[model samples]
Target: MPPRTIGEEFTKGLWHENPIFRQLLGMCPTLAVTNAVINGIAMGLATTFVLIFSSIVVSSIKKLIPNQVRIASYIVVIATFVTMADRFLAAFFPLISKDLGPYVPLIVVNCIILGRQEAFSSKNSVGRSFIDALGMSAGFILALLILSSIREILGAGTFLGHQFLGSWFEPWVIMILPPGAFITLGILIALTFVIEHKIKQRR
Candidate 1:
């Protein structure tokens, strides 16, 4: 395989290898906190911060980690970052922190972060790992943004708490519920595949 350029590594996460849409990693926060746009943005940012920092640390220390204990090491690194993120949210953005509940801290075990560490960061140069993590984070954020926007708009007839629809619009309560999230995500995933297929056909 040809070595991937840094730009390719970064851009791939935005669409081709998106953590949520493409890889289907990090579903917990994607579903749980996406009921609102702000929550999704907060969760996405926190996950991104943790992923980027952990990737940099893991790549830098890859040689020192024993093969047998790498998984444990990765968790420790991830958890440390998660704790910082959780505390920071609590301290500054208490409203968003409260809204997110346990989901924010649950990022410690998020598959996307660990998956990248195991599959990419541990084996790649620090620069490449950083780019990969950034790409994955961007992809994750984009997915969350899309999901949250749909949920907030359809479920509440608002965007970011502002009424976007006219008074005649009735909010679809199911859209903000768990089933609604599932349905919306399913449709989005299907749409993504359709777009991909069309692009291939054009080529």
Candidate 2:
């Protein structure tokens, strides 16, 4: 198999293997905390920190870990970074921390993070794993931003807590609820499929 270029490694995560839109990996956080843009951004960054660090650690120590215990080791490495991210958010951004609640700690089990470690990092170079992690993180963040922006705008008539829609706009209270997340995510995923199909046909 040919080695992937750095660009290929990074860009694939943006769309082709996007954790949310494409692979549909991290739905819990994607749906739970994305009613507001700030929460989405905070969750994205925190997840990014854990994913990147865990990938690097897994890549670095892959050879030392026995096959029988590799999965457990990966979880431990991932958990260490998750703890750091959780503590940092709580200490520096109390409100966002409170908003995120258990989701931040839940990063330890996020398939996007663990799947990458198992599928790519364990067998790849540290640098390659880092790039893959970075790409995946960017994709995750972008997904959250798109979902949160639409939700916030229609649900609360605001973007990132700043009102963009005027008095004429009536907020759709349902857009900020659990049903809203499902509805918005479903639409976005459907649109993504249509766009990808069009692009493939054009080729």
Candidate 3:
């Protein structure tokens, strides 16, 4: 069926139901990875791969799974993908993998992927579910990029590893620290709400 094609399933994960900005899923990795551009991108792609495949598998077998066992099933599926991603990164880029630490494994617990399995993927054909997963992944990546870019520039006086700040620019040491991540994300959330409120008023 046209509605159940792979393209439709994949694109939604890129934008419409974006797991980060729209669905508010997977906040942990989004916040943690944006410290550096490389980290943010790597985390995003890794999550996207996990989400897309999990959706495919879950949707494919939705009819076979019992209602009571769905949550456990979804988590096991997610954990498998996370392990693959973690191992892949460790083998190719040991430094980044070390920096990411246990967070890669923690993707198994990412609320976004599980939420999609329950709220969208389980009820849809495999094709549509895949798109939703992809859209969510894109959205998550976008959010991470925005947050990480802001933090990196203001905190380190650099963007993507390049120095943009003059000597007069005082880098906020806190930006790279864990506390800074919390504060920055908090402010961004507030700003997002303010903009949303303004947009609603216009509509």
Candidate 4:
């Protein structure tokens, strides 16, 4: 691989170092909001917004902060964004915000955001950090979509609330449960590794 450029930093977030499927960070939201497809998308987007803004701010001011207090500063930055995202969702989409519950605010604690700040934003330029954040957000959303699609269709016989299963088909109760989320995500994670491994071998 060539030395990474600015674009690569952001683009890599989408696929290479995806927070969910690639690194398995923020598993709680990955499983919790994924009970329904809509919820999954909402949670993903909310996180994306927070991640992008936080990265931009953190990277921009990286040089100003002392190393000892950097972690605390990052948390404050992340928490601010989380609050903004949470309030926006509640104001515009009360129903979704309600469904997501405190998990929305918990975005502040999501390892993916903090990890990016400590690992990437602390050293990168603002533009690079923006791209990196966007890419990671994309990766997170992709994973959420895959997981939620499976759960929604299987658990409720619906796709984004539209019935896909005919009347004759009964929904699998387990697919909507917390255990189901864990088992399904585990399988998906395993599959992701298997597929990636094969691609690597072929190359």
Q: Could you tell me every candidate's TM-score relative to the true structure? A: 0.98, 0.98, 0.88, 0.96
Error of 3 at 172 (Å): 0.4
Ranking, lDDT, top scorer first: 2, 1, 4, 3
- In candidate 1, which residue ranges exceed 4 Å CA deviation? none
Better of 1 and 2 by lDDT: 2
lDDT per residue, candidate 1, 61-166, as tens digits?
A: 9999999999999999999999999999999999989999999889998999999999999999999999999999999999999999999999999999999899
- Candidate 4 residue spans exceeding 4 A from truth: none
Indicate the TM-score of model 1: 0.98
For all candidates in order, the CA lDDT equals: 0.94, 0.96, 0.82, 0.92
For 5-113, candidate 2 gives per-residue lDDT tens digits of: 9999999999999999999998999999999999999999999999999999999999999999999999999999999999998899999999999999999989999
Native-referenced Cα lDDT, model 2:
0.96
The lowest-lDDT stretch of 10 consecutive residues in candidate 1 is: 20-29
Candidate 3: misplaced stretches above 4 Å?
A: 1-18
Tens digits of per-residue lDDT for model 3 on 39-152?
877787888899899999999999999999999999999999999999999999898898788888988988988998899889998877876877777777777888888888
Error of 3 at 56 (Å): 0.9
